[model samples]
Target: MTRPTALSVALSLSLPLAAHAAPDAAVVPDTTRDIDRVQVTATRTERAVSDVAATVDVIDREQMDRHLVQDLKDLVRYEPGLSVTSSATRFGLNGIRIRGLQGNRVRIQTDGIAMPTSFDIGAFSNANRNFTDLDTLKRVEIVRGPASSLYGSDALGGVVAFVTKDPADYLKDGKDSYVGLKFGYDGQWKGLLGGATGAFGGEHWSGLVNVNHRQGQETVNKGDVRVDNDRRTAPNPQDRDGRSVLAKLVYAPSDTQRFRLTAERNEDTTDTDVLSAISTAVPTPRAPLTSGMKAHDTQDRTRLSLAHEIDALDQPFADSLYWQVYTQNSQTRQQTDEKRTDGSRRHRVFSFDQRAYGLQAQLNKAFTTGSVDHALTYGFEGTRTEIRQKRDGYQVSSTGVVSTTVTPDAFPVRDFPITTTTELGLYAQDEMRLAGGKLSLVPGVRVDRYELKPDVDSIFAQDNPGLAVAQLKKTSVSPKLGMVWRFADQWSLFAGYAHGFRSPPYNDVNIGLTNVAFGYTAIANPDLKPETSDGYELGLRFIAPAAYVSLSGYYNDYKDFIESNVNTGRNAQGLIVFQSQNIADARIYGAEMKAGVEFGELSPALKGWALRSAVAWSRGDNRTDDEPLDSVDPLRGTLGLSYDADAWGVELAGTFVQRKKRLPPPAVQTNPNAPAASVYQPAGYGVLDLMAHWNFAPGATFNVGVFNLADKRYIEWSAITPGLITDRTLSDRFSSPGRTLSASLAVSW
Candidate 1:
C-alpha cells in the first residue's frame, strides 16, 4: 500500500467548421481552414482550439460525414481517452467511460444544456442518454479532463457536447432558401438511413429544420452467428428504427440583441424475437416457468429551448450576456410477452418518464488593469428533474393467446418510485493575459448543490415499518487553473490542474427492498460520500499552416470510487446481488499524441499526399485494494494515408489495439461452480479500413468505405470489461461485426 500521486488522463488537421463556437450550433457544409478552429466552451468565450490551455477535441462535420456517423457509440471509437459501451445491435446508448470511471461520472450535453446521465435502480434500470441526431450536428466538442471549472457537478470525468446545425449554416449566400439531403446503407449493420435539411432566411429572421430516418437489423460476427444465451439478454435478429426532427427559428431585433427558439424530437424503437425470453420449466417448485420471450423497446425524447443574447450591454460591468430557458422530456418503454412452460401467455409492460426544465444565465466582461488583459465569465444555472416509473404484467389464455380487457392489479408493484431532484450551480472563469501576448492563464471555480427527495411507494413494506426513508443531500465546490506559454513561433506549452466531483445519485440512496419469501434483500446506505478526483496535465502543441501535432501526458487521483459488493447469500433467485457503496480510491495515468502532415508543404515531390496518426496508452490501479483498474484503455493507435486530387480521393486506414494483461479478474461473489466468464481479458486485435470518394461537384459527393477488410472477428473492450450479470452461463460475449461494405451520397448547396 502506497498511493500513486494523482493526474490522469487529440487529432487532426484541415477540418471544415473548425472555428465554430462551442455552444453556438455550427453551421456549414464543408470547407477546410488552417489552425483557427474556434471553440467557446473551453473558456466560456470565443477562442481558437489552439489557444486553449486545456485539452479540447473537435470532431468536425467532415470527419463525422466521412465516418458515416450513427450515434454517440460510433463517435467514441476513433477518439482516445474515451470509450462507449454500445453494441451495434443495441437499442440506445449504453454508457460512456472516461479515465476508468463509468456511468454518472461523465457529463453529456447538447449546446449548453445537460443531458441525463445513466442511473441503475435495483437490478432493472435501463441505459438512458437522451437522444440526439447526428445529421443535425455541426461538430462535437470533448473536454478530456476535469470540467468542473466551467460546468458544475457531473463534470468529474469530462464533458461531451453535441453542437447542432442552425439556419445560418445552410442558407445559400444569394438565395432565400437552401436544402440538403443524404442517404446511406451499411451491410454490416443492415442499416438504411436518409436525412434532409432545409433553411430559409429573411433580412432579420431565419428558420431551419432537419429530419432523419434510420432503420437497421442486428449485426453479427463472422459466419453470421447470433451469440445470445441466458446471460446476455440480447435477442438475435433485433430490428431497430429511429426518427428525429430538429427545427429552429432565430431573430435579431437589433444589432446588439438576438433571440432564438429551437424544438427537437427523437424517437427510436427496437424489437426482438427471443426463444427463451422467459426461463423454461425447471426442477424448482415454481412450475410453468417462462420459456420464451419477445420484447419491444422504445425511447422518445423532446426538447424545447429559447435563448436571448446581447452582444453588448448598456452597463459597464456587463459587456455581453446571454440567457436561456429549456425543457427536456424523455420516455423509455419496454413491452415483453412471454410463453410459459405450461403454455400460458404473460404480457409485461414497463415504462419510465423523465422531465427536466432549467434556466441559465451567463455574462462576460473584459477589462485591462495595467499591462494585463483580463476577461471574466460568470454564470448560474438552476434545474429541476422529475422521474416516475411503473410496471405491470397481465395473464393471458392458452395457446399463448391475447388479452383484450385490462387485468386489475395482476402483477407486482412499482420497481422504483417517483423521485425529484433539484440542482443549482454557480461558476466563474477568468482569462488573464500575462507577459504581453506570450502567455495566458485561466483560473476558474464552480459550486454545485444537489438536493434529492424520493417518494417511495408502499411496496417496500412487507407488513409495516418498511425500509423507506428520506436521507442525504450533497454539495461540492471545485477550483481549477490552466496556463499556455507561447514561448516560440507556432509552438506553445500548456499545463492545467483541476478538482472534480460527483454527488451520489437518488436511486442509489432510495432503492432498498427485500423479498423474504423469495429469499433476497437489498438494503440501501443513506449516508454515502461524494466521489472526488484530483487531475493534472501537461502538453505541447505545434500549429502551422500546412501541418499540426500535439502531445500530452496526464495523471488523476480519485477518491471514494463508487461500487457495490455482493455477499454470499441466496435470494429467491439462485444468484446473489449487491448494493451501492463507496469501496476504494484509484489512480489513472497515460500519454497521448496525434499529428497530421501534408507532405506538399515541405517537398513538392510528395504533393497531394497527407498522413495522419494517433496513439495512446494508459494504466490504472485501485490504490486501496492493490488491484489494477479493469477498464483502463489498452495501447491503441490509428494510421491513415491519403491522396487528394482535383475530383477524387482515396485513403487507407489501419487500427491496432494491444493485448492488455493489466487487470485480472477478482473472484466472483456468486457460486464458484458457475465458472468465470468474460473477465478483463481484453483480447487485442487489428483491422484495416479503406475509403474512396468522388466529388462530382461543389454540392454533391459520393463516398464508399469497406470496414474490417480482413474479416477478422474480435470482441471490443467496452462490451465485456463491464460484465453482464444477465448472463447465466460461462461463455463468450458479443463479437464485433464482420467484413462489411457501405456507400453514401450527400448533396448540399
Candidate 2:
C-alpha cells in the first residue's frame, strides 16, 4: 500500500489552485473554500456538481480547512468509498461504512429530513448518529453509492447530507460577523466561537455558536500505555466536551413572499476506557481496578420554511411554491464495562430518547419543448417518529456495592413506545435542453407510500411474555434517470439510475426473543421482511472556469439483509438468547476518481496556489455467504499538496488505509475455543498531514494543523478491540495518534 512514485507523480502534477477558479452560476458563500460550483441535495433537486449523475463529494468550507476537519470521521477524509469504524467505547461507538454496509446501511440527512433513529432501536455501539456540529456546516454532500431510488429504506450504503446556513446569506456589507478561538496541543484543548448577523429592517439574521474541548492522553498501543483496570482511567487523554448552536432567520416580505427560520443545538460528552483481556504483565483474578466506557449526547433541531413566487400561479402551469417544517430532539446516555472475577464489575446502561417530525411540499415551473428547453419539479413528504427507552444494569463488588440488579423482567421493556409513521410521495422532474445549450436531460419519478404502527408495550416485562404486534406497510416506486451531455465548452457526461425501498422495522414488532432450543423458553421472529436496494451511477466531467476532473462508478444491490443469531442454550432468565434474521443477499461495487487543478497560471510566487487529489476503490460482498463483508475496507486513498496567498496558507496531505481480514460473528461457531483466528491482516498505513491558514480580517480566519506525520505505528483493524485489550495489549493495538498539534481562530465581524 505504498506506490505512487515518479516523485509522487511529479509532486502531484505540480500543485496550484487554492482559490480563484469559480463562475458557473457563481453564488458561493465561503463555507471553507475548495469548491467546484458545488450544489447537491441527492436529487431532491438542486443540480450542479457537474450536473449530477451520482458520484458526488463536496466538503467545502475550504476542504474543511485543509483537513483539520473535526468530527464526522474527519469529514470522511477526502471521501470516496467511505469507511470508518470504532466500538469498544470511544465516544458513541462511531460507525460508517459505505460500499461495505454499515449499521442501518447508511442514510443520514439534514436539511432534507428523514431521521429514522435506527429503526427498531438497538445499536448503542455507544449511541449512534453522533449528531453533527462542524459549526453548523454549510456544505457536505457525499452521495456515493446506492440511494434507494432517491432515498428510501436506509439507501443501502449511500447518502450523507449536512447542509446548513442561509440566514440571508449571512450579511456582510451591513456589519455583523465574528470568530474567536484557541486550539489543540498537549491534551488537544479546543475552543472556537461564532457569529453572523446583518439585516434588521428587512429582517435577516444569522447566528452560530461552537465549543469543542478534548482532554488527551490515553490511547497508546505499540508503545504500551493503554490501561483500563488497575489504575489509569478518567476519561484518559480522550475526554471530550462539545456544544454547538446555529440559528437563522429570513423574511422577504415582497417579491413573492419568503420566510425561513432554522435552529440547531448539539451537546457531547465521551469518556474512554475499555481495555481488558489481561496483560500489561499479567494479573487476572478478580479483575476490576477500574473500567470505563461512557457517552452522553444531546441534539435539538428546528426548521420552518416557506416560499412563493406566484402571480396567481401565473396561470401557466405553476411558477413556484415550497414549504417545509422539521423538528428533532435526541438524547442518549451510554455505558459499558468489564472487570470481574469476584471483586465484581459488569455494567451496561443505555438510555434513549428520540423525536422526529417532518413535512414538505414543492413545485416549480417553466415551459417549452419543441425546440427543447424546460424546467419542472414536484414533491411531497411527511414524517413522524417518537422513541424512549431506559435500561439500567449492574453487578458491582469490590467495595462498589450493588451485588446485582437488572430488571425490567431482566430484559424486555419497551416503555415510551410510540411509532406512528406516514409518508405519501409523488414526484416529477424535467429539465431538457439540447444541442443549442450543449445537451441535457433529467428524468424523475417517485411514488411512495410508507405507513407504520406498532404500539406494543401492553404491560412490558420479560421472562418471555407480551407484545409482538406487527404492521408497517410499505410501497415504493422510485425511478430517476439522468443525463447531461455537454460536449465541450467545459465538457460533461453524466449518468444515473435509482430504486430504493425499506420497511418492516417499527421495533421489528415488539422484538421477541427468548431462546432454549433443547430445554424450554421459545419465542422469536415476528414475520420480519422488507429491505431493498438498487442504486447505479456513471460520470465524467471537465467543467472549466478554473479546472475540474471527475470520474465515477457505483453499484449496489441488497435485499432482506438483517442478521442476528445465537440460540445457544439457557433462557427463562438463565441467559444466552439472541435471534434476529433475514439474510441472503448483498453487494457493493465501486470506482471513483477525482482531480482538481486551479492554476490560473500561478506566479506571484505561486499566488493562492492550487492542487488537489482524490482516489477510491471498493469491493463489497456477502452475496449470500460468499464472504468478505462484515466490515469492509479494501482500499482508501487521499493526496493533497497546497500553498496559497492572501494572508497565509499551507497544506500537505497524504492518507491511505487498506487491510481488512477479520470477520468473526455468527455466534463464533459454538466457541470450541474458536479456532481459526488470524485473518490478522492490517498492514496498510500512510499518514502525513499538515495545514495552515490565516486571514485575520474580512470575516477572520486562522487555522493550524499537524497529524500523524511519521510518528507511525499502525493497527486499525484486526477483529475490533478498542478497549478490552490484553494479549499484550492484544499484541498491542489501537495505535494511530501521535505528533499532534492544532490551532484555530476565527472572527466574522
Candidate 3:
C-alpha cells in the first residue's frame, strides 16, 4: 500500500468532498456538461472535452444505463488508467489495457471497423478481443496515449472507439417511430440480460434495429479451495452465452447528403467444467496422470458497412466528407475434452480466423490562412486481412485406439501460415486557430504501409519440418503535436507530442511450434521490428460554471519492444529454442487528476449535490531488462458522490488501489529444495459502489448497482500473472468480485 499509502488513501477519500463542496455563492448550472463532452477518439475529429490535447474517456448511453454495464470489466469499472484483460484460464475477455499496453497493443474499433487480432497459442489456443456488444453501444471512446497519429497499426496501446446506435439515436423527439426494451440482472455472473431496440424514420428514411441476449455463470471467485487438483478456486464450472445483432440504414437525399447502412452480429459461447484440469499428483504421488476436463469456447463477430456523408461541401478539396466501406468476420473457437487417468481420451480443436476488407476516408476543411484559422483533416485507409490458424487433436486409447501420434502433439497443425495482411494509411490534420481564438494548434501526420504474406500450407509443411515462411514489408511514419492555451476565463493549457507504431504481426512473423514432448521448440522471427512509441503530454484545465479541474502528465518511450517466448538456447536436437524478439527498451511515466463539483452551484440547499474525483499514477521500465514493467498498474483512485433529481439519480463510488509493488525480481532459486520464486503482490484495496437511476415514467428507466459495497476481496492488476513465479497458489484464481448486484430495466416507445 505504499505510494504514500496510496496517496493518503486518495486524500482521505477526496478531502471531505472537496471541503463540503465549496462554491460559496451562486454559480451552478453546468448541468453536467462534463467539460462539454464531444469526443471522437481524441482527434479523429469532433473535439471538445475541454478541447482535447490527449487523455480522453467517454462512456455514454447514460454511462451504460447507470452502470449496470456487464462487460469489458463493467466497462472499466471506474476507469483509472484503464484496464480490462481477463483470463481465468483461457477465453474470458483478453483485451483493453492502456498505459501498460495489452494484447495486440490496444486498438479496438466498432463502427469504423477493425477488431480481431489477439491470439495466444499453447494450452489450447485463445483468441480474444471481446468483439463489442455492450447493448449496441452509443458511445465509448478512450484514447489514452500514442494513437499512432490517427490510428494505424493497432495504435500502439490506445484507442477503443465504439459508437453504434443511430437511426437518429432512436428517432428522438420529433420521433417518427422508436421502441426500446431492456432487462438485466447480474450477480457476478449469474447474469441474464435481454435487449431490443427498433427505430424507423421518414423525411428520406432511417431505420435501426438492435438485439442482445446474455446468459451466464462462472465468474465467482473468492476461493474456498473446492477440491479438484491445483487446489481449485471455485469458478471452473461455467456456461455463458451471448448474442447480439445490430442493424442500421439511413439515407437522406438532400440537405447535405448522407447515406449509411450497417449490419453487425456477435456471438459468444463458453462451457467449461475443467475442474482445474483435474489431477491427483504425478506418476508417483497418487497414481493419477490426469482425469476429466472439458471446455468449449467460441466467439464470433461479423459486420458489414457502407457509409458516406458530406455536409455543406463547397469543395476546394472538401468542405466535409466521410466515407467507409467495410466487411469483417472474426472467429475464435476452442474445444478441448480430456479424460485420462489411463482410460485415455483427448480431443482438442483450436481455431482463430479473421477476414477483413476495408476502406475508409475522411476529409474536412475550414479554411483561412491570412489570420491563421484552419481546420483541415484528411484521411485514407485501406485494409485487407485474412489470418487463419488451426490446431486440431486426437487421442483415444486405453482400449479404443485412435491417435494422431499424440505424445507431444501432432495432428493437423498450422500455428501460423496462410497469413495475409496488407494495410495502407495516409493521414493529415491541421487545426490552427491563432490568437483570436486564444491559441490552438494541432498537427498530425501518418503514412503507413505494411504487408505480410505467407501461404505455406500442407498444414504448415507438416508442422515445421524445415520451416521458412517469411515475407514482410514495412514502412511507417507517425507524428503528432498539439497545444492549446485558452489562458483565462476558465483557464486551460495542454500539450502533447506523439508517435507510435506497431507492425510485425502475422503471428509474430511466422511463428511455428514443435514440442518434442516438451523439450520445446518455437521458432520463427523473420527479422522483426516495428513497435515504437514516444509520447509526452502535459495538461491543466479548469472549467467553471460549477467547477471542473483536470491535471495530467505523461511520458512514454519504447522501441522495438515485442518479446515473446524468448528462450533461444539449446538447439541441435536438445530442443528448447524459442524466439520472437526485438528485445524491449521501454519506459512509462504518468500522473492524472480529475475533479468535479456541483453543490447546486452553491445554494438552493445543495440543489442536487455532486462531487467526483479521480487519480492515477504509473511507472514502468524495462530498459532492456533493467527490470520492473510488470505491465505497470498500481495506484488508482476514484471517488464519487452524486444525487440528481428531476427524476432520480444516485451514485456513490470509491475505488482506491495501490498495492502491487511493481514486480519482477524473484526467480533464481536453483533448486535448494525447490519452490521459491515468489511474485504475487496484491494487497492494497478499497471498494464501494452503489448506483441508482429511476426515470420511472414517460419512457421508463430503472437501474441499480451495488458492487463490492464492502465485500471487498480485491485483486486486479489486470488479473495477475506478470512474471508469475509459479502459480502462487492460484491467487484465488485472480480474485475480485465479492459483493455484487446489478439491475436494469429500460423501456421506451
Candidate 4:
C-alpha cells in the first residue's frame, strides 16, 4: 500500500464537503464559524476576528477545560504552525516556537506585562520561560507574524498574550457568591492536579481567590533500555512539583468607571537523576571521568498590578481610556552534583534573576468627516528591567580536600556584568472606512528608544582581568499598513505589510570567559547589530451560513541575524578564540488553509455533526550561506470529526506530519583527526486521538481523552538534534510517549 503524503491530505481536505458545522467538541473550535469572536491582542484593541488583517488564533477557558490541557505542548497540539522546544537530557520544556524562530525572538506576556527571557549556559544550566499556570488564565491569543509595530522589541517573530480571569467572570448573572473545585490526572507523567476558586461580589465591590497544585514523575516514553550508560534510551528518573496562586479585587463606582487590582505567584521544582551523563571513558582506559550525576532545578515568579478603565466619555480627545501599572520579579536556580570514577566529586550551582516595572496606557476615539468614518487609537509604554547571573563550583578529592580552582574554570564567576535596560515607546493607528464601508484601510506607526547600561563589579573584573563592557543606546521606528476589501456579500480580501526588529541582548553583547587549561577563550564583542525583518501577507475569506473557508500566504525577509559563540580563529597568545557576530540573511515563506462545514445543513437527521480541517506548509533559506534553514518545521495538518448533543459530546481527531527533507550539507573536516559532522532527518508519521465530555449535572462537567490510540512509537521533528546522528544508540531517547489517558472533573456552585 502506498503511504499518503502531507500535500495530498491537505489539498483533499481543503474542499467544502457540507454546510455549517458546530465547534469541535474535543479540541479547538472551527475558525471558519468563529468570525464573531472578539480578540484584542492583534490590534491592542477589541476587534472581531474577521476584521483583523493578520492571522490570529484564540483559545478560551471552555476549550482548555474540554481538552484537559496541561502544559505548552498540549496547548499547541492542534496548531500546525506552532510548536514547543524540549531537551531529552535536560528533561523539561524550553519555550514556544513561532514560525522559524524561537527563544528570545518570540515575545510572551500576561496582562500586558512581559515575561522573563530564557537563558542557557553549556549543558548544566537552563533558565526557561514556562512561568505561567494554565489554570489561572481565561484566554490566550496568538498572532502569527511580526507584531513589533505595536508591541515594540522582542516581537520580531510574533506575540503570545495570556489574559487572566477576573472576579467578574465568576460573579456573573447577579450572583453574590460563588465557589469552584477541580481535579485531574495524566497517565503520561503519572501526575495529579487539584485546584479551588472562590469569589464574592456586592453592589460596589468584587473579589476572588484561586489556588492550584500539581505533582508528577518523569514523562514516560517508548524506550525500554534500562542500562546505566550513554547508550541507554530510556528517560532518567525524575520528580517534579508545582504550585500557583491568583487573587483579584475590583471596585466599580459607576457604569462607566472601574478600578482593578491583581496579584499572582508561581513556583516549580524538579529533581532528576542524570543517568545519560554516566560514562566510563576518559583520557585513557586506566582512568574513567564520570560515574554518576544528579541535578535539582527551581523557578519562581511573582507579580502585582493596578489598572483603571473609563468608557462612554464625552471628552474631545478620547471616548474611552485604559491604563495599567505593574511590577514583576522572577528567578531560576540550578544545581548539578557529579561523582568521578576515580574517587573524586564536583558540584556546580547557577542562578539568574530579573526585576521589571512598567506602565501602559491607550485611548480610543471614533468620529466621522464628510464621507469617511474614522476610529483612531493611540498608546504609550515605558519599562525598566534589571538582570543578574552567576555561576559557582567546587571540586574535592577522596581525602576531603576541596579547591575552588578546577581544571577548566574558577568558582563564583559572572558570565556577564549586572545590566539594566530601559525602554519608552509611542504609537498611533487609524482605521478609515471608505466606499460605503466596503473598503477599510489601517495605518500604524511606532517609535521606540532603548538603552542598555552595564555595571562591571569586582567579581566580573576578577574573572576577566582587562575587559571592557559595552553600553548600547539606540532608537528604532516600525510602521505597518493593512487593507480589507469586501467585494461581495460573503467574500473578503485582506493584505498587510509590517516591519519588526529585536534589540541586542546583554549576554550576547558582553560575554566573557577564559579556559587556560583547555587552551581556549571566548571574548566579548561591542559591534553587534539588532536583527530586523519585513513581512507581507495576503489572504481571502468566504463566510456563509453553512460553510466557511480561508486561505492565506506570507513571506518574510530577515537581515543581520546574530550567531553566538562563533569560532573566530586563534588570538595573539595562541589560544582558540570565539565571539558573537551578526552575519546571516534569511527568508521564509508559507501558505495555510482552513475549512469547515456542518452536516446538519444537509439533513435534519445529521444535526449536531461537523467536520473541520486545516493545513500549513513553510520553507526557509539562509541566503548568506546558500543553505536550507534547519529551524523551519515540515508540512503538517489536522482533521477532526465530532458529534454534539444537549448533554454529551465526542470527537476523533488525526494529526499528520511530513518527514524533514531540507537540511544543510555536512561540514567538511579540515583536520583528518577530527570527527565528522552529520544531521538527523525524522520520518513522517500520523497519530489519532479520541476525546469525550459529559455534562451529567447542572454546573458540573467531566472530560476524558485517549491519545495515540494505536500506541505508535514516533519522534517529533522538533525534538531531534543534529548531534544525535553521531550516536545511533541514543536515538530512542528522543521518541515521544506511547498511548496515554487523561481525565478531569469540575463542579461550580
Model 1 RMSD, rounded to 1 decimal = 6.7
Model 2 stretches astray by more than 4 angstroms: 1-48, 53-55, 58-75, 78-93, 96-141, 144-149, 155-405, 408-431, 438-441, 448-464, 476-504, 508-597, 600-688, 691-749
Best by lDDT: 4
Q: State each model's C-alpha RMSD to the native.
A: 6.7, 24.4, 24.8, 7.2
Candidate that beats the other on lDDT, 1 or 4, i.e. the better one: 4
Predicted model with the maximum TM-score = 4
Q: Give the alpha carbon lDDT tens digit for every residue of 70-121 in model 4.
A: 8988888888888888888664888887888888899899988889999976
Comparing 2 and 3 on lDDT, the stronger one? 3
lDDT for each residue of candidate 1 in 1-749, tens digit (9 for 90 to 100)? 12111100000000001112423324443435323566676677888888888777777777677666676756765666677765333343576777666666777788788876564332123647747777778877777877876787788888877778877767655667988899998776689999998889888898999999999976555433334334442336678899999999989888777788989999988887653233422624344555667778888889999988888796787788888899999888877776666667777667778899999999888999899999888888889998777655677766545553222222444544577889898988898998878999999999999888877656434321355556568889999999999999989999999999888776566654443333444556677788888999999999886789888999999888765433435545563434567767888999988788888888889888888788878899887778877777778888888887877788888888887678644434345686665444546899888888788988898888888899886666766534442242322435676788888898887
Clashing pairs in 3: 28-601
lDDT of 2 by residue, 494-538 (tens): 887776666655544444433233232223445656666777777
Which regions of candidate 4 are displaced past 4 Å?
1-35, 282-288, 667-677
lDDT ranking of the models: 4, 3, 1, 2
- Candidate rank order under TM-score: 4, 1, 3, 2
The models' CA-based lDDT, in order, is 0.71, 0.56, 0.79, 0.82
Clashes of 3: 1
